[model samples]
Target: MDLFTESGILLLPRDTFLTDTHVQLLQKQRIWEVEVQQVLSEGTTENITNQLMDLDADKETVAAYVKALDKTRSLFDGIGRDDKPGLEQFSDVFYEVAEQSMKQLGLFRSLYVLEGSDSYTYRHSLNVGILCSLIARLLKWGEERIAFMGLAGFLHDLGKMRISKEVLLKPGRLTEEEFDQMKQHTVYGYEMIKQMEGGSELLALCALHHHERLDGSGYPHQLKGDEVPVECQVLAIADMFDAICSDRVYKDRTSPFEAAQLLWKEACNGKLNIEFVSHFVRYIALLYVGARAVLNSGEEVEVILIHQDEPMRPLVRRSGEFVDLRHERTLNIEKMIG
Candidate 1:
């Protein structure tokens, strides 16, 4: 049967195949006693029942996420208009979502898996915010600093609102002129934030320098090493990770493992902070320890363990056998299926 939240948002369509992950997500949303077709064989029913046992659930988290997305959409829609949203407006909504996201990693993980393809900007903003906060927590920062990091990440792309949709949404290689205009988003965001109430120089600078790299290879001011603030450094990692893992007009989404590898590569090339990349990439790799993935060789496997030295190349289980990616260097995880 079809499932809808109390707020009337469709949660799942009728007859959707319920994987173990799906069931766990529903349980997290406090959804129990779902009506399903009685077509499962006796053995399948027993297996599902066993998997459903001892699950924890919470409804508010999912509801808060939906409301946060709606709020984000509304705020983005008002950009470039007379009633553009202020820093306070964005913070108010962001805190609500951040509170829910911090409750558990599962909610944050589910967001990536269940996200729709539309509204890329709004979704990207929210996801980056959550990721920034997560990275801050992983760094053992104080609560206030973590909150600031999230806000910084959330507003880092505000300048994109000023770009012409024709250029922003173009699906092919951009003309040199178009690319130059696109790069101005940092400047635009900086100006916009500077004008907003409660927006500080640091906040505006985050929007300005988030694209800046350590190797003097970044734009708006090719700042190298310490020229970029530590805050902007963190924002750069979160921003790049999300962009690579997310679908864009011109490219398909890469898997998180692959994205982590790329981040590590960039760090090694002096474009990103190697220490920060090491910490964040290890966490990202560990997050998918139990996930299902398709390897480059077309074999489906379940990640069984993450090697600390090579988190991206984990030990995986395939067809009742184990494949140690560390030794099987020819094969790599192509993408996650769930």
Candidate 2:
């Protein structure tokens, strides 16, 4: 076992036999556990079992995710047919499930690689809602504001419900005309929420502007920075992130780590808010420090350490030797397997 300090200093090298003096040395360093053969910690090494669940459903983690997803779809279907679902009612149900999903599990654990395309939009909505709450908490927003952030995220893609199955579920890339038509959902959603009796104007605005990029490159209104509300900015990051982490009909999914890298790149290119992206990237990287992942090369690797400067490029251990992803240009983390 290799012993390290609480601050990650190498106090005792690997292969050293455990002795009374070594135990005292570890105690002095305030180290609780050693990195056994450089394997990741319990939180990540036991990742398969760490999946967040909706305890109200009394099901397994995957089952709970499916349950919440189906509930969201049913609600959207109500909206599609002009049922005019109640905003407070919807928020109540959403808060119940989103809150349950976060129980015991740390933030951002909702970044799962979904297998099918049938439930993408609604699942994306819930994922974004959950992620928004996390981002709000990270930003030190108050409880009520954080709840509003989550509700905004849940309703941000509500406009997509008006889109037809043919266009929304197209197997490949959308035609230019189809893409333009798809973009109308943002506007459609804004009007839908605006007509609701108890809906907040901020929530309606978030629904409309969630697709608006910071550089005025986004569609519809072509909004730019400061023109975009901080609430919508949080929704934008969460929306883009869930979309990337999920498997779309036109493209395969990227790992949360890789997706974070993509979000960081977009932020760097001035498409996203840099302040939010930087904080979120580091938060994501830190969560997976002891996690297991599959690389693009089809090799299984264990994340060992997160680089402070370049968080996306973490040090991973495969088989035994350590590989610094920052130095390896070709191999990239494809997705988490455990």
Candidate 3:
């Protein structure tokens, strides 16, 4: 059996699975590896299990991460634009390695987001992976398929490495010429993934077809509905979700509710799969449960669980008016108050 340590290391055990409690204890102590002789010399399985089960979830780790994400966003803003090519290449390598590590750990969680980014492409790629994994889990996809989608999501923009920095970061509207160049990253990413070892054609297909739309109006190829693979369809939705939500030279980062509203509208307009859009919307809204938030009235509160039918508006208890955000169109979630 394979055992995972708290430090993110894995070891092969002679026999038996570690109890959930032992996992908790290791998680609590942050002592990933103990020379079995040193830590467990004569401890019984029941003893270890009891200790770990008593440990609480790591609040300190989560708080540290909130601070780290703020730092990472600032770091991305400062990275030299001239190093776009190098950063993009390194981003691909990083995600590829992250993909392998994810498979080994059986974790399809948001480590890619934690990995952070020094470039726009890398940041967007990691967001895609996080968003895609969220969608996959909501759809009840098996673990391997989820990981494959996560990897595909992470490298969906691998072709951007070939595009020029000036075109990518241009503050003004892209001229027709610059716009054409920007679109080539999809094809560029496909070719790179195709050449990589152990690459899936499905993943490369996501690279090629993520830009294609249901109305036959998207770039690279104008393939309409049913012509595109399901994987491609899913990736396309994930790509659009990440792109619209992030900050750009011309656009500020969109609020998650605003992004969700847009996704809902796009689904209605036939730009996304209705089922995929519905489930993905539900998935993302759930992740922010317990997050501190601001209402349009400027009141502060923590979000409770979402109402099952009306996910766009979660049930939140604030310090002021007991307004139900779902019913009150005027009051909305202002932002995540980190």
Top candidate (lDDT): 1
Worst 10 residues of 3 by lDDT: 108-117
RMSD of 2: 20.0
Structure candidate 3, residue pairs in collision: 25-52
lDDT of 3: 0.62
**Residue 52 of model 1: what lDDT?**
20
Per-residue CA lDDT of model 1 for 15-51, tens digit only, reads 6756677899789778987877652111222221222
Model 2 segments beyond 4 Å from truth?
1-64, 106-111
- lDDT tens string, model 2, 240-277? 98898877778888888899999998999998999999
Q: Give a tens-digit lDDT track for model 3, residues 45-159.
A: 2322232233332434332323333333333323322222333443444445444433332121222112111244555665576567657767889988876777677768867
The Cα local distance difference test for each model comes to: 0.81, 0.78, 0.62
Clashes per model (N, Cα, C within 3 A): 0, 0, 1
TM-score per candidate, in order?
0.81, 0.80, 0.66
Q: Tell how far residue 305 is off in model 3, in angstroms.
A: 3.8
In candidate 1, clashing pairs total 0
The residue ranges of model 1 lying beyond 4 angstroms of the native Cα positions read 1-59, 114-116
| Residue 327 alpha-carbon offset, candidate 3, angstroms | 2.2
